[model samples]
Target: MAKSTSGLSRKRMGEMYRTMLRIRRFEETADDMYMAGKVVGGVHVSIGQEACSAGVCAALREDDAVLTTHRGHGHSIAKGTRLPEMLAELMGKVTGLCRSKGGSMHIADVSKGHYGAHSIVGANMPMAAGIGLAYQLEGKDRVAVVFFGDGASNNGAFHEAMNLCAIWKLPVVFFCENNQYAVSVPAEYSTSVDDISVRSKGYDAPGLTVDGMDVAAVYEASREAVAHARRGLGPSLVEAKTYRFFGHSRGDPHYGMYRTKEEWEGWKGRDPLIVCEKMLKMTAKQKKAHADAVETEIREAIEFAENSPEPEESVALEDIFA
Candidate 1:
């Protein structure tokens, strides 16, 4: 069941709506670019899970850090990553945040404390826990937030990372954006228990559930979790129960295969963008204006990406360590 969010203010609600729009437009462009071969190595689209990214990002401070998965564009956008650089990175251009060496799945903007994203399933969780450990050692309160899917929660790395964070009392928040599928495997078939949150008890961390469709619910939950971590409290886990409108990746045809058309429609009707727009009290005209602005921003970024020069061959091994 989607969580209730009735206390959000008009301004904050408007921001959430805009952020969703930004993600939608940016991803739309990415899809087109992928089809055109501009975005190399392909990408996992986050067309339906905007709320989880935008909401959780809103709750993070500038000093906070995050690690994301292959389906990471939304997370990057939510962290205020510059659209031009992100797009350039996807294009493998020199102007990219990663100097075009890291391409789509490895875009990193450490300036934003994003610490980069990972293509390997369940791998970033351990890295995020390590970041938390470093912060503790340095006597800093920076919290490390790791985003993964329900499928990742079942991996050995997930358990190991959770145990490490727990034993160390690390300031890490393991936020699982469970979109109900792990690349065509429905979550119901993968896990014995229904809710992923319950697994946190094994690590002695507080487990929580939030409305991944409602950006406000995610923001509230993330805010509380981050505050606790910043206070030197131990790690926590948040299972955002959400659904993905698209397939797990650009190639997977999720519609009418694993789920029914009716199920997709039911979730789409409650699109987080629409939810936030309604909460902002914005009429159709106002909503359209904001949406158009976001679209425009994305368009400029795409244009910049298309025009950016690709990385030179000489630098292929620049960042690699033997």
Candidate 2:
């Protein structure tokens, strides 16, 4: 939108816009379902952070592996997960991915190269490195992308995983969706550096931070980082400066006790939905049409999930990782 810095074509721009809308609508619908007590476990939303998910996944291939954080619905959607099955998974239906066993935090569709969504903070980094190593050993050019939050960046796993990937030159992209807050703790108080990407130097890898609200900026950065890893250039850290519109999970307030109303309003102004529409110069009719299409899709997904049967209890323990 700003002088074509990313230089994305109109088609790609529109596709990314659609992706952002799909994630936005999907999360909103899921949150509503959670509130209605129609889902299992808790729902961690990535509503305002759609640009980060959509932009990065847009740069990746369907066969490239992906590991997601708890707040990873958008990541799954961006990585080409079917709406019906993903929603069904959240609904704990037999038709869902993992046959309703994995529910919210553990939805895995390996057929699409999605390993799984790990609930433990920073836990999936090691798994990502392992996958990257597998690709390297097999002489495959595919890369592995792991998504985590700024809070997880401070964990020992962050350093250990990134350092390991860096030293071994593993084909992995350490993607960070720094939403500025980890649950109730603001990043300013917890993190030492203003930009998380700078810490990549500690592991002898390249890194950069981008406007997480701007999909074009994120897309360009992600494309290069993904390409870098695919070329056997080791790991790269990408930090997206973003803010979550909702609380850390379902039942949490928008500006809970810790966040100020002013801070919330400030970030709301840069809502990914608004920013994406503006970037694409979408007309009022076009915007409505896009949102309508997403709504229709989400509505159908909910019906499918609701109508699908739950997994049979007899087979409950059959497909576990044991």
Q: Write the per-residue lDDT of candidate 1 for residues 158-257, one digit (tens) a residue.
A: 9999999999899999999888888878899998778898899999888889889888888888888888888888788998988888887677675877
What C-alpha lDDT do the candidate models reach, one value each? Answer: 0.86, 0.89
Tens-digit per-residue lDDT, 1-322, candidate 2 = 1112857897898888889999988888888888898998778988899998889998999899999988888888899888999999998888998788778888778888999999999999999999999999999999999999999999999999998999899999999989998998889999999999999999889899989999988899889999999999999999999999998885568885788899999999999778878877889999888888888998899889999998888767786666
lDDT of 2 at 308: 95
Q: Which stretches of candidate 2 lie over 4 Å from their true place?
A: 1-4
Instruction: Give the best candidate by TM-score.
Output: 2
Best model per lDDT: 2
Q: Least lDDT summed over 10 consecutive residues: which range in candidate 2?
A: 1-10
Cα misplacement distance, residue 57 of candidate 1 (Å): 1.0
Any idea what lDDT model 1 has? 0.86
